[model samples]
Structure formats: structure tokens, C-alpha cells
Target: MKGFAMSTVNIYKEFTDQKVTENVKKVSVIIPNYNYSRFLNERIDSIVHQTYPVHELIILDDCSTDDSRMFIAEKIKTIKDIPIRTVFNETNSGLVFSQWQKGLKEVTGDYFWIAEADDSCDPHFLETLMKPFDDEKVVLSYCDAARIDDDNNVIRENCQDLYNMFDSRHWDKAFVTEGSEEIKKYLSVLNTILNVSGVVWKNIPGLHDIFEEAKNFKVAGDWYIYTKVLEKGSLAFSPKCLNYYRKHTDSVTSSVHCDIEYKEIVSIEEMVAQKYELDMETYRWQRIRRSYMDANVSPEVKKKKIAWVIPYPGKGSGGHRTIIQNVNALIRHGYECDIYSEDDHRTTDEQAAQKIDEFYETCAAFVYVGANPRAEYELCFVTGWQTLEMVRKIPAKQYGYFIQDYEPWFFPMGNEYLIIEDSYRRGYSPITIGRWLANKMETEFHTPAQYFDFCADTKIYHPIEEIEKEDAVCYVWQPEKPRRGSELAFRALKILKAVRPQTKIYLYGSAVDAPVPFEAEKLGIISVQECNELYNKCAAGLCMSASNPSRIPFEMMAAGLPVVELYRENNLFDLPEEGVLLAESSPESIAAALLEVLDNKEMASSMRAFGPQFMKDLPLEKGFAQFIRSVDHLVLHTEYEQPKAEQIYTRAPYKAADEFRAQALDILYTDEVSSTDAAPAVPSLPRRALRKLRRIAGRGVRMIRQRIGKQ
Candidate 1:
């Protein structure tokens, strides 16, 4: 069916001062179509069956050469009741320009929607999309989109984690609240702007001007438009998949040229940067340049254009070692390299200064590795253990959060909000270490990120001693917290101890004086010099995480030791199947996994052989290179990186509370009827007046009935 048309009268103007106006409730859906005749009908049908009735569908057909026009003409005859207006373009016009100029001109309702012809939405899409606009500060609203294949089967899910959208603390708090006020509060803190199809934008001041300026841009138009809108007001987001974004072979998104798109995107982004008064153009350019490097370009050209930056060398934990190895690998390749750390103080008595000095000397470039108030580093590289508070103090062009674990969990409630606020405010771009974290960052924070898995130095972590067939060794870093699966590990060890008393269990990391619950040896924290020795002698490793992926699995694999892993459902990252045992976080499951790994010699040997190869596959050098490349691309593609709103009012946490409340009241009272109403109805008197009138009429009727009885 053809989409709805704009109302004849100026609905917005008529209801501008109508406290409780029906216009506020009405939605104008603008579906722009080119030539996807096959999917256009289904999309229109979905819109027709919407649960919310106060809506008009506006369709713009951009001079399609196919049967799209015929399809629309035939469908419009059948659906006569639904207000559908069809606009045919005389000549071919690009998607962004056509929508910016003609689409805005045709829009007559309170908000405008862009439902592309190939995409479809759930019946409740309008209801959910409109909820955010209840607060006036929420100029734009978006919902998660479900990814569907050609057959309409759900090929993938696009559920957003709240952590990625707001501060970690705010997300945690938002999920725990029972009131709508809490949701509104969190939305104010993390002003996410994107998901255009899932969004409904209020026709506010400067919106038209912003669209007109961006009308001529072919690629990155949506990005530019959203960035501009964010400058004017806050954004609200729904995690629910109200819209379906179809992936087809002939989609414009898939066919666009990288260089051409990059150039246009860069130009627009630079314009935005200047307009917004942001000072992050250099970081933006670097990100864009990396994208060009990854595109179909020559290797020599890429090497010359995009240089790699690595944090200086240091004797760190397994995680830090991986980082150093990765940097070394990139340097080995034909890429320009620079390293930054502290000055040469390795021989000094102070441990921190000595470490910094050693780190600096080993790399190409090195500065002090602390809170640098004056450092002009383009990007601040942060390790998992580093404090986000300290990272915020640094004046870097961009911040790269290299998380090895769910490190934010360590902070007190509301602290993560501060950290995320600082990063975004400073125009930093996040780069996570794994798929799980990357997905979390993208969906929840509304920040784009790349996943660079931990790469191991296979040269250091390898099988040096012969495997003892009779003995199975279990390594425990700590046997305390349940989240670490320590309780389960202890239970499994007890069972294994009873069954195979000779099996040795080695505990590492923390020092414990408690009596042994089972036949296990406790090895307190050891020097780095002795870690490799212990790993080489071990037959297998025990790896576990309550809600996140751990690095121990990869480390064990590198040492040719099969790993018995406790699987948690929330962990969405990928793991190597071979040499890794997946078990539920239970005593029985843990025991079973341990038994399988210890008893099966052939399986153990297979895992031992597979470990080295897996380590080789995820070399630190390759992952680091990929990371550098990703950062480069992001810089190039982004036009202007706007500071996150959270930082603007972070010092006064409740600074926007009054403003938010005021805006909410305006949205609620602006319409002629309750914004929740589905259709037009007769006006009703105040509840108090209606109740009094009904009582008075009942009394008069009662008195007349009594007189009749007396007669």
C-alpha cells in the first residue's frame, strides 16, 4: 500500500499552544523508496497495521525505473481508508538530498519518520518510538533494528546493552529502576543519537536549516544530520527491536565506493567540527585515513599514509606482555612506529620510575606514563588496570580504552558514568579488546569500537617440558569470589581429590592461609621470572569468569596446556574450541570437564598441538595492526565528533533535573488531548466537576422516588 499523506492544514501550528493537543500524538511516517518493488509492499502493509492510529504515512518514490510505481498504484486502490500520499520524482535524485528537501516540505505532523522501502517495522514501532518524545529534551528517538535475511527469517539479533549507551553506573541503575522517571533520568545522561528508521524527530527550530545544509551530501548524510540534531537536544533510545533492517545484495550501503564515501564523509565531518566548535579534527582525520588503508588500496600506499602508534615496552602481566608483543609485530612490518612511556629511570631505586624508564628505552618514543597535564599525545592508550579517572585527566586528542576484562565492574556505582562522560567529552574513540566488549560499547554507549583480541607471544609461552601422562595439574589464580568460579573450582577439586588423590592442584596469584579444603598446593604470588616455568610444567589450566571472557584460556593454550573453562551465558565473545573444555558453572560440570581433560591422553595431545597454532593465529602483532587500522578508518569516516552530553553537566550531577522536568511537562501539555490517546474523542469535563454533577442528579431522583412512595 502507498504511505500516508501530510495533513492539509498546518497541524503543528494549530496545536502549538493547545495544552493536550491531538497533533502531538499524531505521527507522520515518511517512507522514501527507489526501486525495491519486492519489499515495498510488505513495508507498507506493516505500517498500515500499526496499533497507534494518530499517524499519516508519506511515501516519496524517487523516479524508480522498475515496477515500484505500478506496485504502489495497484496497492493504493485496495487500501483506501489509510491516508496515503504518493509523490513521484520526475528525475532521479539521491536519497539524502531528496529526503532533506522534499521530505521535510511534505511533513505536516509533529514528528517525521524515515522508513526506507526495503525495511519493515513491528506494529508497536510507533508506540515505542513515540514514548521518548514524551520529554521535550528528547528531540530524536530510536529503537533497535532486527537484522533479517532475504527469506524473512531472523538471521541476527540487534539488542543493545544499556552499558554501551550510557555510563556503566547509569546503565546499571537504569535497569534496576521501576519508575519511568529513572528511564528519563538516564536518557538525559547519555544522549545517544542514531538509528534514524527507529527514530522520530520533533520538527524543532534549526532542524530544517540543518537538513537543508546537508541536502546535497550523498554519503554520511545521516551521520551529519544526527550529529547536528544532537547539538540542539538530547536523544532517547529503546533497546527493543521495533524495526527490521533487511540486508540485500543490491543495497546502496553495500555498493558505495569507499574513497568517494570517505571524501564526502570527511568534508561533512570537518564542517560539523568547525560548526560545533570542537577541536578534534586531527583525531577525526586519522580515523578516516585508516579506513582508506583498509579499503581496496595498495599495501605501499596504506603503509605511507597510516602510521602505527604503540605504547612503550614494559614487564607486565600476561595482558601487558601481549600488548608489547603486538606492538613489536607491527614494527616488524613496513609501518611507521612510535612508542610512548616514561623517561629512562630503569636503574633508579624507585620501582615506578625504573619501570617507566625501561619501557621508554625499549620503544621508539616515550613520555612519562602518568597523569600528563601538558602532553600533546593524539591518543591516550589505556590498559585494563589503569584508572579511567587518570585517563580523563590526560589531554589527548582521542582515548583508546583497551579493556582486558569487565574492568568497570571494579568501580563504585556511578563512577563508570563519569569515566564514559570524560572519554566522550574529550572526543575519545573506544577500541575494545574482544567481540563481547565491542558489541557492548557500540549498542549501549552509542560509540563505535573495534575488537582486537589478545595476542600471545608464542616464543615465550610454549611447551618446554615433557607432558607427564599420570599427573594432571590444575591452576587456580584465586579460590575466593564466586564470580571467579572459585567455589565451583574448589568443589570440583574436592571431588577430583577424592577420586584421583594423586592429581596435583596448583593455586597462584593471591596468598591464602586458610586450611586446604582439598588436597591442593597453594602457591602465592610469584615473580614474573618464575611464571613461565610454572606454566611450562603444568599439564592443564583451569580458566573461569562469572560474567565476562577471561585471558587465561588463551594463555593456557599458548603454553600447550588444555584448558577446562567454566562457561557463562553472558559471555558473547568467541573462543577456540580445540584444547578448551566448556562446562557449566557447576561443581558436577567442572568435575566432568576436568575428568575428560585428565583421562583422555589422545585428546590432551590433540589440544597440546592445537594450542600453539591458536596462539600463532592470534598474534599480538596482527591484532595490534588491525586495531591501528580500525582507529584510522574511524578518524576518516567521522565528520565531527561531538562531546557526549554527560560531561557537560557531570560536576553538577542533578543540574539538568529541572530542565528535564520542564520539558517533559511541555510535551505532555502541548497536545489538545492526552498524548496517549489513539484517536479523536469528545472533550470531557474535569473529573471533580463530573462527579459532583452525577451526585446531584442521583439525589434529585431519589427525592422524587420517595414522594411517589408516600402517595
Candidate 2:
């Protein structure tokens, strides 16, 4: 079957047996009323006094508390020429489509008009709309509409002109076009048919199933039903301005929430795209343009929107936590924010939204897992190196970068590293998470950057009690990740164990499946509360990173646990004090630092006293304030390009390509993933024991070389 581009001439040719007759077509005028008593008389008069003849009229009252049922009952006494049937619902069905279904089942006419209770049509509405059905292929015919206020004064002259702004082909001219072609081009994007009162549909068996399917949707049911009915035959457009769509504060469409409506539109478009195999790029552009138009915002009062393109937040990731925090902070300050991720990590939209609600419960930022619908934000912020490439293809007024760490260091000194390094030089204003990164970007790349301090949640990770401290050492161990210096930490822990064999060892952050040379308790992938409890019990904490400092040290300090880490530039920039013992990346240096904090009680006490106070000083609010100030500076200082039609259309194919790449990668690299279900626990060794093991291994190698020389 042809999905989209069916011809009207062919529709008529196929139905040649059902020949058109000279007699006038019987019309069923369905008036579904609900509390529109003030306009009911006018609506009834408009239909009964049509210039053309009607065969039957059906009036359904959806249990309105208003006097509409009584009003309609009395008005029927005056309409003697047309056969009329009246039914008052016992209770409200809560859906307008339900009434349409009821009226359709009883109607015996060749065509049906759902004349809404609050709207009125011109005297020639039925006559003008029914003329196109002269050809048996015309299953649906609708006229252009005039928007009117509650008092019946015209608000806009022609609604079709605004509807046709994006496509400029069909509504501007009258045509009896194929149903599939009409839906593929226009109706797939948005409901071009302005009102139910303006439409006249043929009573076919296919329309019943369409109405049933439409019942699943509340806000965009009419649009869905219109698309399905059009697939049966052809659509006829009458440019005669014969219908007036009434806009009021209390109407059903006006009362529904805006997000729900947009979400429903997205759902409908996805269903249509899969069914018809339409050009996804065109559909994507249409979704965005339609949203901009549907916002109906005047140019004067519109606020700017921003989007953050980041990776999917797999379990136990500090990067994901920081991104969520930044987004929530921006949203709290009245900036509308949205998050888009190329990889969803096998998460559904509902599951992602729920997780977002759990993390930043106060904010209502949207999370899109796959292809981002047309949001048309004023600014786009790229949060990761891979996302920088995707954001380039996404349409936005201005672009910026959210730099947490130098991403090139995550890879080796090769092609991937160079590509990631080039991402920083894309001419976007950079927002850094720490002062060291800010200074590095400005000095090396000549990119003037805005920087914010890293902070921990003291409310969740605070000193519990003096009694909670135990003789246990905690380590943030992520073994598979080479950048965390897991081997260095394990060697140091081995040394610490030999010197202090009585101390208990605990590990968290991830689970381990591989064999390790030492023993420790693996409390894998824990919640914030459990993590805080573990930190409170431990006397000292170990955190190592080859590049920037990990968030684990700050969190450990918030729980009053003294931390030992590599004395890298990134760590020295933040924790160059007595609270955190610093050492070189060598196993000996790390082991000595860990032993100093673990063995000396007075030094441990001094560090513990300073830990919580230092973390308490650098709260999330301080960082958020800096971030907002930088965003405001850029938004006010930078000039954004005006939106153009060609830009939006040209950039749509990138998302499709990105989706293909993500799927191929998922198939190829199945093992190198950190999904929540498959994450492994990481193990660690003690401090002084690491030195003994190294000496033993060195002696064994020397003995083997001596034996080879004798041979």
C-alpha cells in the first residue's frame, strides 16, 4: 500500500462503482455540548438554518451542570424540517472524543459535521464544505477559519495563513488532494484543521476504528483522528472563510497543560513517522516549527531557553551528578533548561524523567533519551567532547561549553585525544568547574573562561558523631578505569596493610569481578546515605586521579574523614592544606602519606577537625551563583544570530546519523560498558604491604636472571 503520496484522481478511479449522484448528499450535523449554554442557541441556529439542506441532526449533552440540555430540548421544538435526536449524558465522560464516537455510531448520513457547542459557522458553511464531495473519493473536506473571541468579535482574519507559514503550499490554495499526501506533508507536523466545527468527514467503517484509537489521546485526539480518516480516501480543502473558532480562557484546549500537549504531539508524530516511513529530518524540523508557532508568544515577552547536550548518566558517575546539579541550579534561577543525551543507557523516557525528579526534585527540566524534538532553545551548552560534535548539528541561536575536566586526558596521546582537545577551541565561551581548569584553558588555549568551585552536599555528607569513628580505612576504587590510578592506590594500600595490619579496609564506588592481590570489603554502588555512613566510620580515605581531582575527596571531607591523594596541580589548587595529605603519584609516596594519617592519632585528629569546616565553606550555592553570573554575562554580552529556515532544515540529518553511530557502537563494544546491572565492585590493598610485595617480586626476577646466566 502507498503510505504517503496517494493521488485524488486514483482514489476516484478505484471507487468507480460507487458513482456520484445528482441528488444532494445527506449531512449529519453533530452538536456535542458541554456547559456552553450562552452560545448554544446561536450554534444550533447556524446549523439548522444552513443554506443547504440537512438530512438529520444529533445533539449530545455531556452532563453539563449548566442549562444547555434544557436549552437544547426547547430549541428542537422549533426545528421541524430536519429530523433531530437529543441525548443527555447521565455523567461527564471527561473526553470530547467519546461524544464524537457516540454520534458517529448513530449517524446514517453520507457526511458528518461535528459542530462544537461554543462555535458558530457562516450560513453557507455546510453548502461550501459539502460541494467537494461531488467526487466519491473526497472523504474529508474542511474550510478556512476565522478566530473569534467569546463576544463573537473577530480576533484574526484568517487562521490558515498562520498555519501555512512553514509549508506554504496547500492551505493557501484549494485542492482535492490525496489523503496520504495531505497527511505526509501537513497534518503529520501539526493539526492544520483549525476546529472540529470546520470539518466534515464521511461516515466510513474505517473512521470508527480511527475514533477508537483517538480515544487514547486527550489533547491531540482530533489531529490523530483527522490523519487516519484522511488515509481512507482524499482530502478536499475549501478556502471559503465560513467557520469561526471561538477562543476562551475556559476551553478544554486552553486549560490543558502545555508540556502534556507538546509531549502528545511528539508521540503522535513518532507513530506517524514509523507508519508512513516519512523523512525524519523534515518531521523533526516540523515538530520544532510547530512548537514555536504553538507557543503563540509575542516577540516582546519571550524568555530565552537553553539546552545541555551531555552523555547518559549511568550508575555511580560523578559527571552525571554534576550535570544534573548544574541544570537544576540554572532552572531554579528562572532559566528554562533541557537535557539531551545521544546514548540513553537503555533507559526509557519515563524512567529518565523519574530519575531526574529524584535528583533535582524541585526543577521540571525535560530529559530526552533519543532524538531531541524541536525545542528551538536560544542557547546550547556542550558538556562533553562527543556532545560537542552533536551540538554543532543541533540548531540554536548561540553555543557555549561546560568544561568540567580536560577531556583529552581521558584518552591516550593519539587521534582521539587530539579530536577531544580541538573541541575546546570551537570559539564557544567556556564555563569551567574549577579554578585550575579555568587558568589552564585561558593560558594554553587563549580562551577566557568563567570558573566555579567544586562543592559537596554537607546535608547528606556531614559529621555524624565522635562515637561513629572506627579504625577502618575507606578507598574510592574504580579498577577498570585506568585514569583513576587504581594500580597506584592498590600498591599504596598494600604497604599500609603491612604496617597497620589491625586496621579494617573498605571499598566502594564500583564492584569488582577480577582477582586482586589483597583483601577488602566491597560495598559496591551505594546510595548517598550509605556512602556517608561508610565515610563516617573510616579514619582515613584514599582518592587518586591522574588529572583533575575526583568529587570523592570533597565528599569524604564533608563526612569528616581525612583524605590522601596525589599532589597533582589539580588537587593542590583546591586542597593544599592540613586536612588532605598530598603525595606524588609514586606507590612509595602514596603509601607514606596514607600511613602518616593512619598511624598518627594527633595528626588524624587535627585533619578530621578541619575537614567538615572546609567542605562547609564551599557549598553548592556558591558554585551555582558563579555559574549563573557567568551565564548572564554571556547571554547579555554575546550577540545571537536570528533564526532562519535553512539552518533548522539543514541540521536535522545530524541526529539521524548520531543515532546510527550510537547503535553501531553499542553492538561493537558490548563489554566496555558501565551499565547499572553490570557494574563491578573494585578492590584495594593496604599501605606498607605494597613495598614488601614489590621487593619480593624484584628478588624473584633477579633469581631468574642469575639462573639464565649460569645456563
Candidate 3:
């Protein structure tokens, strides 16, 4: 806090743009006090202890209820070098501008500074700010200020509100611009100069008239008065934060909405536009600035865009689809969403966006080929494990993970898995798809996590009463996706076909045709409407997951198709058993669970009745609202109540059958099945488990594949 003021080193600088001149300027300092006794002594010290001395100092106490008058009298006694006066008002002036009017009557210097009693400035504030007056056109000179607390700790080094309005980065450096230019661009945009304590104004004739006219309105009088002052001459600004503006916890205008403020803001906008003859572009921006005046409405945070870094998506990629869906949701809620794609396939941004619109839902996000965007985002989301590195290179105020799955399971327990784990260790407050992924992040990685529910588009994947049910089953078998458990699901379908040979089988959700041992129809890459029809036709659908359960099962249940998934912690925390069945990881268990749903009509009827009922509460809109609330937390720089992770799936998975209980048997043994009909999924289920178990046990599964390939 000390030794960093401009006077700590040297106050003088060589000026090339403007002529450098030395002058004896008479500077008057005014401390307008009202119930700020705690800070009065320090405020007086800051003004009197300046590197450049003041010509006169006047401390005006506006009948403060606190002991400010006593303090002001005591403070005046210590100021021996400068001529100082203490004026105690008979009545408390209700407005700050009234105090400014009262103090201006006592000012005898050529330049006057209305230093608020709650704020303090550096020793070189006078020396630095007074120099700009050497140019006769400079009427008011102000330097950048640090926001400080009553305890004098710096909240922020430089006030960023100066740039937030027009994003004019003049606060980053020193400049002297025309006063009318200031009024048109900045003052019209709602007081971009911010604090008056940072300003030293030349005590020009008729300045009192500006304050008297300005004080007619409350809440925006400072802004209006600045415009009036700047109209007289040029405005000078130094970027060095030499002034400290104290913000109190109990500020009246801090969180309250005032109709006077809103109305006056609109009035000023119109007045400035017409007075300066501002072009339509500046006038349009001035109108947009009125939204910030509504305190009850959402803050400027909603105006900031959220950026996403995602892997280059393929057609029919559900992960990328979910990312785009939420991006569109945000856009609908008044946030700009820019999606950066990491595509090594040399895909153009247009091509990638076209593919997204073609395969996934239509998105309103701006799609870019690389991670770098032109503007820095307020919050950037790294959409997956693959794009974490790419998102790191982006410029953002905060970075987070848009986690859909427990991505470590997407790969084997090796290099990529370890890197994904480290990505979570980067301590991103991840916004997950469901409670299970959020719970995993909070418990395992110890990061703050937020979740939106796994909602199916009920209107699309809904019941079609015309389609009659068949003694059939469908499997989501995407071989390219490791988390889908394609091999496990494929084996389960084989056993189901073996048990009841009359059962029709179908596989979908993949574009590339691959060979399967079982008898089934491959309806490769069905549309959403076609998927709804398929879900209605089948009695059961198998959607297996080794990680967080996919939304496919939810959609199936919504369409009255009872779904079966592997019983794991990932599934147990989020998936409900009403329309979904959780089975142990084996061919026998999955086949048995599918059979259980098909065989029991009473249970199937209950699932059909409740699946959509449950989905009613978990619509895409509800999930989107929750996501928006979590993201708004980032935007407002405030944390909502951090709730403990609660488990939704309270019941354990259905018990594994007692048909195959030989713990000491070798899991590495690979048994060959001659045909789907030849292999009975009966008491020989123990032998049926051998091949899948070998795959789980590792090397033997690959060896058996090698042997089959040779044959």
C-alpha cells in the first residue's frame, strides 16, 4: 500500500504529444463530509500531505450525525502549512451535489477538487493531475482510481467500470481529449469517469450554475454535472491509479433500484445525444446503456458471452450435440455463445457448423475452426477432455469444464486417462450433465460442481400409440465410443436371441457398418422421429455405459421402452429404476434384465405410466434453467448455496443371479460359441460369461480374436 504512489519514484514525465510547461497553479482541496468520521482524519491527511501543496483547504461538514464536526475541527489544527477553513452546515444537505455547491463558495484557488470525505488520494495526486492544466484547454483532469474498503485495503488496483461501458481502453493510458468528445462518447454513456474524488476541476466562472442545475435530479447528478463541466474545455486523464475511492458495506445506492436513477439516466442519454448531435451508432449505444440502471434485472453479466472449446464433431455425435444444445439455450437466455472447435480433419468452420445443424439440433453459436477467439470471454468452458489443452490457450476471465461424462473412462487406464484426471485437478468448477458426473467431480476431484439433468426431448422421443409392440429388443452399439460398452451390449443381445429365438433384434446409432455374430437388423443412423418409432415398437432397449449413463436410455423410457444399463456407481447415482433397469456387468445379467422387463407385463405397464410422468419434471427447459443459474454464478462472481451431493438412485442394482457362482474359476479362459441357437443362455450361462470375462481380464480376449481371425 505504501511506496507505490507516483511521488514514490518521480512525478515528472517528458511529454511529446503536448507542449511541456511549468506553472504555479493555485489548487484548492475541499473535503465534503457527512457521517464519515472514521475516514475523515485519513482523508484530511492525504490532502494536506501532498507532494504538491494546496493553495487552500476547506473541510465542510454537512451536519453529520456522527462526530465529524469535532474531527474536522481537530484535523484543521494539525494542518499548519496550508491555510485551512472549517465550515459546519446548520442543516444536513440531502444530496452530495448540494455539498459540492456549498464548498465551491469557500474555494479561493484557481482549481478546486471536491474530494469526498470517504476517499483518499496519493501524495503526488496534485502534482500529477495539476500538470494537465498547463494546457489552457484542459478544464477537468482526473486520474484512474483504485476501489478501496474503509480499512484502506485495495479491492481492485484500477476501476474496470471505466472500460466496461464502451470498452474504450483509454483508462489503460494517459490522454487528453476534447470535452465535447468526452461528453458524446463517455459522459453520455453513463458517467464513465466514475468517481469525482479523482477529478480536479478548474474553478471556471459559472461552475456554480452547473451544480445548481445538476442537483435538480438525484442518482445521476454527478454524471450530468461531468458532462456540463467537460463542455467548457478538454478532459485530461492519467491511467495511474493515484486516487482511492472507498466503498462502504451499507451504501444506499449499492443494491437498491431507484426510479429517479432510471428516469434521469434516460433523460441524460437523450439530452447528450441531441446536444452533441451524436450519430445513430452512438445514440443507439446510449439507449442500450439504460438496461444497466435496472437493479432488479439481471446485471451486466448476462451481456457477457460464454465461450466453449469442443473437439471437432462427427455427424451423429451425441456429446457435441449436447454441447450445442446448451449453447443454444444460453443464446435464448441473452448470452452470446461462441464455440471453438479443434478439428485436425481440416474441416472449415462452416462445414463443422453445417454438420452440427444437419446431425444435431440447430445451434445459434458462432463456430470457429480454432480455439482462439477475437474477444476474451468472461467464462470459457472446455467441453471435453480432448479440448482442455486447446481451451487453456484461450483468453478468458474464468475457465471451467462442460463435463458430460466421467471422461477418464473414455479411454483405457493409461496415458489419456491420466491426462483427463489431471484436467479435473486443474480445479475447474465443472457444469456436468447429471448428478452422477457432478457427484464424481465433487467427491473424487474436490471441485465445485454444477449439474443439469439428463433430459430427453419428450416431444420428439415420445409415445406413438399406432406402433404395436413386438417381442423385440434394440441395442445402442456405437463401436467407436468406448464408454458405450459395445462388446458387452453385443454379447447381451446374442444371449437374448439364443434364449428366445422368436425375439427380433435391432442395432442403431452408428454410421459405419460392422460385423456382428447375432441375427439383427442394422438401421444405421436413424433420425429422431425414426428413433421414437423404434422405441415404441421394441419392448426393451439396451443402452450400456461404463461411465456416466447416456441420455438415450432416458429418451427410450420417455417413449415407453424400458431400458437396461450396467449396474455401476455411475448409473446408480442418477438413473431411476421406474423406466430403467440396472443390471450387473455380464451377458447373463443384461439378458435376464431385458427378459424381466419383457416377461412382466405388470411392471412394464408401471414403467410406461411413470417414465413420462418423471420426465415431466425433468424437461429440457428445467435442465436449462438450472444450467443458467449455475453459469450466472460465474457471471455475478457470487456463489449460490453449495449443496452436498445427494444420490437420486437410492436403491441398489438388482442382485446377480445364483446360476454362476464359482469365484475361483479362471476369467482368462476363452470359450467359443458355435452359433446363437447352439449357445443356450441357460445353466450354461457360466460358460457364456467366459468370453466377456476374458475381455474384462485383458490379454485372452485379444488372443481369442486373433484365433478367430486365423480361422
Q: Highest lDDT: which candidate?
A: 3
Decide which is better by lDDT, 2 or 3: 3
Off by over 4 Å in 2: 1-294, 344-348, 354-363, 371-373, 638-711
What does candidate 1's lDDT look like per residue over 1-711, in tens digits?
Answer: 111132111111211211223434767878888887988877787767665654677888898999999998998787765677888889887655555557777878888787788787777777667766767777777766666666565545553442343324432211212222422232222223334566778887787787777765666566667766666676666666667767775555332355555455446434543443322222323333445335554333333221222233344334444444444343333232333333234422244434533532232222244454533444555654444456556555556665555554545558674664445334446666666666666666676766676565565676676644337575655544335766556655655555566777777755655545555667776653355556667667786675456666766788788887766533435555666777755454566567777788898889989988878787655567666666555544533232221111111111112222222222222233321123322223454543343444334434523532443
Question: Per-residue lDDT for 581 in model 2?
Answer: 79
Q: Candidate 3: misplaced stretches above 4 Å?
A: 1-302, 660-711
- Candidate 3 residue-wise lDDT, 622-649, digit = tens: 7788888888888766666545557666
Judged by TM-score, which candidate is best? Answer: 3
RMSD of 1: 33.7
Q: How accurate is candidate 2 locally (lDDT)?
A: 0.72
Writing each residue's lDDT as its tens digit, candidate 2 over 568-621 gives 666656663667877756555566677778878998998888888888887778
Question: Would you list the C-alpha lDDT of every candidate in the order shown?
Answer: 0.55, 0.72, 0.76
> What is the Cα-based TM-score of model 3?
0.54
